[model samples]
Structures are given as structure tokens and as C-alpha cells.
Target: MFDRFIDYVAKVAPDKIAIRSFEGSITFAAMNRDINRLAHALLDVIDNSSEIVAVNYKQVHIHWMLLMALSRIGVASASVSSNSEIAEKEIAILQPDAIISDTLFDIDTAAKIHVLDLNWYDQAMKRFKPDPIYTLYEPDRIVRVSIAAGTSFMRHRIDYTASMIESSVIRMITQEKISWSLMSEIPRYPTLLPTLAFGSFHGFLCYLSIWSIGGTIIMADREQYFAAIAMLSPDLMVISPAQLQLIAENLPEDIPRQDHLRLIVVAGNFPNGLRHFVQQRLTKNLNVTYATSEAGVIASINIDQINHDDTAGWIMPWIDVQVVDDQDHPLTYGEIGNIRIKSPNIVQKFFQNVQDTHKQFKNGWFYPGDLGILNEEGLLRLIGRVDELYNFGGDKFYANKIDAVICSIEGIKDAALFSMPDNDGIQQPWLAIVRGGNFDIDQIARLLEKEFYNLPDVSVLWVNSIPRDEEGHVLRNHLEKLAMQYIETI
Candidate 1:
């Protein structure tokens, strides 16, 4: 399968620049050669079966090559991003046979039997023997593992066999017809600028898919992203909604230079006004929504289907979606309930927490804890999380609703709402605001009071900024701690 992809690259634009960053650019031949060298290095690290290796590296050129090499060499590898101590702890618990680090580390307490620094390995590969042949390679038979960031007391583990990966990939490609359709629809020369860390899923997958079709993958950092967008005038660009909004808000009005760009894909929840603002400003571009992870693409929205009022667009093909009640019974279209998904790309289970694995993985469906409704037109609209809804005086209030209202205010840049424990230890909803500039708190409170009559006791606090995880999900725990500090002071 991979050989076919490599061959396609060889056939179309063999000398095209495939990957680039602040450091430099690597042509298609150089990228393929680097993959070969990395594959050999991986083979050297794990000379025996059942050897697990933990890869600790940032999202760099070498890291991407290492991942592909590990997959090619049939090695079980788990990737952890920078400053992810929780991920490191989970990796230690897995007891991998070897740990690969990009820099020196004193993780003496880890259960890993051996440590291999990647810098040394890369140097060693340059002096190694004849280059390894570009042969067909499949994912290793070893079990896959992942951590569960759910509200559960214990973390969970995920395991998927090699056959499962192959089957899933094939099923997705067949069902979505991505290979054939994308080849015709996508531009002859496409480039991507992926956000580093686990969020690279979209850019990474698109890069690989484009490479499979013999296209280039342009690497971009914060500094070069703007300049490169103008210079390269890429056929396609994948970015988050937040980043897109920043670009739209920051760009000068008279620039008028991005007409060459064909598509700009944005993911994550977006405000309606901001979406409209972008659409009005960028008249010639096609906007798309594609949300993906290490697993695969979860959902997508096309430019034509984008409704400024709705957050997410249509569900992708091959994704069996349903809204379910608390008891897991399916809800009809237009009914608000928990969003449940059944797809070949969904992770089978958690790594080691058998109980959680069993509880969460049932009948081939994964409940992601998000609440949404499917309209009569077959469009999905995410409202909020199931647990993020709070009851006040027998009335229900959603955090997203409050946040939407607060964020719509002119001075407010971002807003977060959470239920905080009162003096009686009862959970009461509290509001937090991240402002763009100084504003009258009394006026803001009046606006909220008029809108949320049932939530009369809402307390407002000004925060420097709202914390978010790598994927842009609100860091509720951090917000709760900040709320506690604020309440104690008052």
C-alpha cells in the first residue's frame, strides 16, 4: 500500500519540495531517502520482537520521519509531545522496552529498559551501509495504546491490532472514496502548514494523502506562515478556526493578495459572526471544515454547507452518528442528546484500563461526551458537553450558551462559564471573562441579566486568559482552580 503511494510521488513532481520549515526545505527524493534511513535506524533499535519503544519528540521533520519509519519497521511506538508529564507517566506505566529521546533526560525512574537518543541515531544512520529498499510495509501486530482524558478517576488504555489498522484504513478509503475523489478535486501542487503537537493530525494526514498522490507538504511555523501563504500561494491550507479568525482580524484591509489560494480548511467551534466576517472578507476562497486526530477524520463541513449560526457542519461520509439519551438509547433527529459515533477509525479501546475499555467500547460505538443535535437537513450542530449543563432554580443553563452570549459583547475577546461551589457547597454557575480592553462590568452584567433571567445569581470574574488544551478544549480543571481562588478572595 505504501509502495503504491511512494510510486505515485515518484511519478508526479519527483523533484518538488515536499517538506519545509524555518530550517530549510527537503525535496521529494530527500524525504524518501530520510524515511529509508530512519527505517533502518528503527530496525537497529528494536532487533527483537515484543520490543516497545516510546518516542519523545516535538513536531519536527525528524519526528515525522521517525513515525513513518517505526510503522515501516513494524515497531510499537507511542508518541508524547513536549511538557506532557502526564503522557510520560502513562508511557512509563506501559513499560516500553526502549525509550527514544530527542535530548538527554534523567528519567531514571522510568521502567524502560534502554534509552536511545535520536540525535546520536541520526548521526549513526549517515555512516550506515547500503540504503534499505523501499518495500511494502504494514503496521506492526503489537497493541496500540492511548490515555483517556475523561473525567474518570483512572486513565484508560487503547489497543488495536495491525489487522485492525489496515482494515480500518482500507474501509475509510473505500467508503469515503478519498483516494480517487481527492486526486481529481485537489490541486496539482498542494501544501500544508500543520500546527505542531498532537494537533498535527489534520496536517499530517493531509500531507500523507497528498504525498500518496504525489503532492508537496510545505512545513510552516508561526513566523513563516503568513509570508509563506503570500509567497507560495498554496493551493490548500489547513488551519483552526481560532487561527483563521486571528488572521482575518489582524490582516490589513487593502492587502488583496490571496486570490491564488484555492481552499482554506478550518476546524473547531467558531462564532457565527466571525465566520461571516471571514466569508465576506475572503470572497474568492473556498472554506472547508476538517477535524482529525491520530485516529482519523471525525467530521467535516464544506463551504457551501456552512451556516454562520451553526458551529459544526455535516458529518463526514462513513461516520455512523446518533444522538443518545442518558441511558444510551438513540434519540431522533433534532432531539438534543449525547453524540455517539461508530466508525472504523474510532479507537477500539483504552490501553490498559480494562474496565474503562469495556465500559466505553460497546457495540462498536464510542461516546465522545459531546452533546449535539442533527437537524432535519442532516446537519450536526454541537451545543455543549453533556456534563457542562448546570441547573439553576429548576432551569437548565449551558456553558456554551452563556459563553456565546458573553463573547458576542464588543469588548470581550473570550469567555468561559463553569459551575462553582457556593458557601453552602452547592454548585452555582459562575462566569469568567477574558477582555480585549477595559469595559464597564456593570453594563456587561446588565446585558447578561436581561438575557439570562433565571441565572440571576451569576458571579463574574476577570481572568487574564482562559487555558486550553492542545486541541483547544477548555481546561475546566484549571478554570475551576482559578474560580476557587477568586471566590476565596471575595
Candidate 2:
């Protein structure tokens, strides 16, 4: 599969830079040689068909090359960023046969296996080059396992089989060509700014896809993302909606060529207010994408299709989407229900949690626990999480909806809404806002009163920062704990 991929790239543009990181750039030929050397080193450590291995690498290019090498060698690679001490704890629990590291790190374990240092591997590569051989692999075999950024001991397995990888490469190549074609049609360049970290699937996959097609991927830290926009003057960029909101709120008037950016691909939880803010501020459309760690990209809306503030778009050809109710009964069009999908791309099961694995799959469909409505137009609009909704005075309200409305306010930086028990021991809705100034609580209360009259008991609390998990999801449990403390103090 990799040979085929390399052949395709070689035919297109082999001498072009395939991987660029903070360290240096690697051409296609050099990257191929590196993967071959790594594969040989991996073979020396373990026989073929090794299920688990610890890949300790920080450079983005190394991660991609390692993934390809593992796929070719028929090994299930588990990658943990060097920053993760907790990941080491989980690695001890899994007890893989081999551990590959870019640098020597402290990992207290009993697994006696080869620890291939990347620096040493690179140094050795200068004097050795192996003959290229066509390697065959079982397309259905598991190739990669990615630990989730959620609670400890709960890992999300990513099984990138050969067939899945092939499909992914084809789709990405097609998308890249289409994006470039569109750029030519419009005569504009699309600049990519991906958020780093092992947990970011899109950030990892998109960068690899762009590199495979000889495109540039600009790497920047969280702060550097905004700084680059101010100084580097990119024509197009991709960012999460939350980051876009932060950029819009904190942008300076002297931002260089701010309007030059033609497109912004905003993914993850697409807050409605942030979409509106982007449209209003830049006078450009916001492209929202619905994607997941398990499944690559389910659906996406282009800038031209951002009408009615609805998630109306085509589902990716590779995805099989179904709307089902609480009882797992499939719903017809125009029905509002839970969204489930069946795709070879999604992980068949979680790494170690059998109970979650069973619960996540129903009738061979991966239930993501999101409630959505599929309209007659075949557009899917995610409402909220099935477990995140609350009933107030017999009226159902999604926490995300209230969050979007509160975050739409000019002064509010971030907001989260959840239910809490009142003095009467009845569940009441509460809104927490992370703001910069003295916000008028009474005025905000009146605004909520006018908009959400069904929510009779609404409380407001100012917080320094909204707690977020490593994957950028709002930690509702932490917010609930903080809300209880604020209630007691008041």
C-alpha cells in the first residue's frame, strides 16, 4: 500500500518536500528511505504481525512516517506524545512488546524490547540504503491505536487498516486537487494552520495529505497561530471555531491584510454565534465541518452553503450515516434522532474498555451519542449530545444552544450552560461566563429572561477560564463543581 502511495507521489512530484517540521524538511525520497530504515529497525526488534508498540516521537513528520511504516509492517502502532506522563502510565498497563522513542525518556516498564532512537536512526541512515521491496498487507488488519485525550485508562483505538488508509489517501488526494483547482478557479492560495498535539486527528491527517500532494503546511503553536495571522499574512487558513472566536475578539485594528484570507475551514463544535461573528467581521463565509476522531470527516458545509445557519452539506462519500432513535430504530427523513454511522474508517472497538466498546456499537453502527435532525433536504444538523440536555419546566433545552447564545454576546469570551440543583433540590439551569470586565449580571439575566423565558431560574457567574479537556471539549463536570462552589459562596 505504501509502495503504491509512494509510486503515486513519485509520479506526481517526488523531489518536492514531503514533510517539514521545526527541525528540518525531508524530501519524498529521503522520507521513503527513512521509513525503510525504520521498518528494518522495527523488524530487528520484533517478528512480523506485532500487535502493539510504543512510538515515542514529537516531530510531526516522524509520526506520519512511523504510521506508514507500521502499516507496511503489519503492526498496530500506539503513539503517545513525549509530553504525556499519563500516557506512560497507560503504556505500562498495555505492556507492548517494543517501545520506540525519539529521545530517551523515563518510562518505568517491564517490556524488554528495542528502543530505536530517532536521532541514531537518522545518523545510521546516512551510510545505509536498503533495496526497495513490495510489501503486502492485510487491508483489514489493525495498524494504529490512538489513546483518547479524555479520562485516563480510556483509550480510543484508531485502526487504520490498509483499505481504510487507501481510501483516506484517495479522498485526501482528491480533496487536495479539488482545493487547488478551486484556488485556480478563484485565483487564491489556501494557507493551512493546524493545531498541534497527538489528539488532533484532522491536524495530523490534513497535514499529511497536504504534504503528500506537495503543499505547504505551516506549523505554529497556539499563540503563534494568531501571531502568524497578524504578521505572516496568509491568504487562507483552517481553525477550530473556538480559536476563530478568540482571534476575532482579540484581533487588532492594524492586522495586516486581514481581509486577504478568502476561506476559513472551521471544524469541531460549530458555535452558531462564532459563525455569525466570522461572517460579520470578515465579510467572508465560514466553512463548517463535522468530523470525529474515530471517523475522519462525516460531513462538511462549504462557505457558499452556509445559509440559514444550518449544517446543510453533503456527507462524505466514504461515510454511511443513519439517524436512529433511543431504541436504535432507524428514522426516516425529516425525523429528529440520534446520529449513528457505519464506516470501515471508524474504529471497530475501544482499546481496552469492553463495556464502552459494546455500548458504542449497536447493530454494527458506531453510535456517537449526538442527537441530530436529518431534514428532507438530506442535511444533518447536530442538536446536542443525548446526555447533555436538560428539562426545565417541561421544556427541553440543549446546553449547546444556550452556550451559543451566551457566547454570542460581545464581551463574553467563552460560556458554558448546564443544569444545577437549586435550594428546593430541583434542577435549574445555570450559565457561566468567562469574561474580561465587570459584566452587568442583572442585564444579562434580563437578556436571558427575554430570550429563554422557559428557563425561569437562570444564574450567572464570572469565571477566569472555562475548563477544557485535552481534546478541547468543555469539561462540564468541572464546571458543575465550580458552579456549586460559587453557589455556596453567594
- Steric overlap count per candidate: 6, 0
The models' CA-based lDDT, in order, is: 0.61, 0.63
Alpha-carbon TM-score of each model against the true structure: 0.84, 0.82
For model 1, how does the per-residue alpha-carbon lDDT over 343-445 read when each residue is reduced to its tens digit? 7656766655666666656788876667788876657877776667778768888777888888888788888887777779887877788988766777667
**Candidate 2, 53-95: lDDT as tens digits:** 7677776556666666765566766666567596576576555
Candidate 2: worst 10 consecutive residues by lDDT? Answer: 180-189
RMSD of each: 3.9, 4.1
What is the total number of backbone clashes in candidate 1?
Answer: 6
| Residue pairs with clashing backbones, model 2 | none
